[model samples]
Target: MSDLARPRRSVLYMPGAKARALEKARGLPADSLILDLEDAVGPTEKEAARELVVQTLKEGGFGLREVTVRVNGLDTEWGEADIRAIAAMGPDAIVVPKVNAPADLHAVERLMDDAGAPAATKIWAMMETPIGILNAREIAAATPRLACFVMGTNDLVKELGALHTEGRAEVMTSLGWCLLAARAHGLAILDGVYNAYQDEAGNRAACRLGREMGFDGKTLIHPAQLDIANAEFGPSEADVELAKRQVAAFEETRAKGEAVAVVDGKIVENLHVETAKKLIAQAEAIAKMQAG
Candidate 1:
């Protein structure tokens, strides 16, 4: 995917074992759909889930949203089979849970190779456990195939013995560390899902908080959360206007052979110009989608 093209602001997780949810997800407004074969599917249901996911991809009518499969961890009995199945289906990405080191990624890479998966089948890592947080940078920097980090806050909370406070203070350090690693490696990072699927107010608050914390988007549990997540992550009208003004001001300065420009009493530099351009581009993309 192009770095310039913003991904689906809300990535909905559909239980791979549930064919109905998988089919329903195709009509949701979520930017991406994650067919989960991990925590969502029990051991007995894993094989069934894999088959359903593979069939869904083969059927191929998911609209503009990207598709991904969250395979069981490599340590699990079904992990290898999940990888092989996913490779055959050729979804946009494969999400690996609880990745602790570069070696974990290397193992998955080899599995993908053996399956003859296309190079475009990227890998997304879950930064959840304490060890995963500690080695987040090393794992993110491990290979070019690493595309993104999906925060697994529930696991992190369990590992840290943390209570769910309003601001999530207990897990702030790990979240920050994960963001740092993702940005350092130029990878997209998503905030974890909010467990209360029907709590609209809480989900909106969490989405806003994730945006403030520099997450590219938020993983979602239900389609009800899609609107809020997309709104929070996407550029606002005010943001687009400011970006346009900044670009105009900067361009005028450049034409005058000046390297810097003052906008609304604030000095704007090249960095500001770059940010404005990105904002405008994102706004345009969103507008096009809305128009369609």
Candidate 2:
């Protein structure tokens, strides 16, 4: 299956400066890893970290975890260098943080192209600033290579001068806007990381909330958060079974020249069947990743 259709239930962040952490990411169960060069790296170690990230991506110990390098923003001194360096190694995607407009994506795409980045290498834009939240739709549709939006909630909160409540009450409007934009443009949207890594209960609750918010997954700060994120976002066994039944019933109806089918005493339409097929495909993709 294509990476686009693969389940991205838990995307963990690993600091770019830590060689050991990068090496250890190979064993994590997270669906993807953002090799962070933005907030995670110190200014003094930016260049060194960039080198390490590039070397690490080329070294290739990261199993099925989709590797994406989160570069510093174009406005930063290290941003261009980070993109140019990471482009050479060609990680799955280059994540640009704090994207305020489509012009931001356009600038990054131009840099990636100039750096000889492969066509398959995608761009993951983070919707953080208030301007970014407002312009999400334009940004999502800005580039054909735009793959997903990684919400930078910490920055967002700082920008809005809003409190980080237990349920992210202040951030709901921003989240909802970005989610709508992503869905409208056929792009994947991942929820922001829960800051309280020590609070497992809080983390789990937050993950559940993100799942209920129609997020494909949640960005994680610690590997310890993976279990809850995966469980909450990945299709449950019961859900998979129901999806299987729906798909079978719909396929049978299609074979019989019918437009609809009844599954579990409920009417199933074409859209329902489509959802079922996606569920099954996602499950299969996750299974394949886990098997390896």
Candidate 3:
């Protein structure tokens, strides 16, 4: 964790080649905009897309939302150019797809260093493949520069040969592993994009499930998914109230020199207090953003 606190409830991916979409995203509610040069760009257009991405970054008009460039796999020809352009332009972060080992992070870090990228420029990994899930912990623990993990549920589903059930039961194991790895490293982890953009009910269901599964946010393919993602990730009024109550109770006990506190007939530990404080802080931030 870079101690750079960002609310990434909704991350929307835009094709790096589409200048119009890039411009239009400035008004969207997405917390992050990913200029995608990987899956979105065609083979013939990869170089052109990289140029457009560089131009967009150089122009510098994306509002408060975080901007990330999703480069092609490091093994590909376009990947080198993508990395070079991104390093030169220097967005908030570079998202590397299909990262399976610590070596991948090392390679990227070296490239970034060679490019003389700022230390503030962070790396976010997409854990999609089988090898990636298996080695996620090692990969996450590999670098202090790693900030977050974005799940590629669609790719993982394909690799595992599993169907997307109503409740996402098939991908539960991999999802759990991703959350565990992220928590172990104290990094933010986002759920993969829900492909059914037109299906509002399906999108909300998936977003709710992701929140229940402890994801910090969900990656989105469409701008329409932004509101639902944001709403799902934000703490509810009841939740904020409960968290405040827990904190108050814990503080009252601490004032009396007591180590342990009981809240709502349940034991509240230091971990619980920390969680409550985080929730309150997030809630306040979201409220302030909404107010403005």
The model with the greatest TM-score is: 2
Candidate 1, 1-292: lDDT as tens digits: 3742766578889999998898898788777788999999998898988998999989977866789999999898999999988987778889999999999999998999899889888899999999999999899899888899999999999999889887889888998999999998899999998999898899989999999999989999878889999999988899889889999999999999999999889999999999899888877766665544
Question: TM-score rank, highest first?
Answer: 2, 1, 3
Report the candidate with higher TM-score, 1 versus 3: 1
Per-residue lDDT for 20 in model 1?
89
Per-model CA lDDT versus the true structure: 0.88, 0.92, 0.88
Error of 2 at 212 (Å): 1.7
Clashes of 2: 0
Quote the lDDT for 161 in model 2.
97
lDDT of 2 by residue, 1-292 (tens): 5756968999999999999999889899989999999999989999999999998988897777799999998899999999999988889999999999999989999999999999989999998899999998888889999989989999999999999999789999999999999999888889999998889899989989998999999999998899989999999899999999998998999999999999889999999988888988889988989998
CA RMSD per model (angstroms): 1.5, 1.2, 2.0
Candidate 3 clashing pairs, residues 3+ apart or interchain: none
Of 2 and 3, which scores higher on TM-score? Answer: 2
Candidate 1, superposed: residue stretches over 4 Å from native:
1-4, 288-292
Which scores higher on lDDT, 1 or 2?
2
Q: How high is each candidate's TM-score?
A: 0.96, 0.97, 0.93
Q: Which runs of model 2 end up more than 4 angstroms from their true locations?
A: none
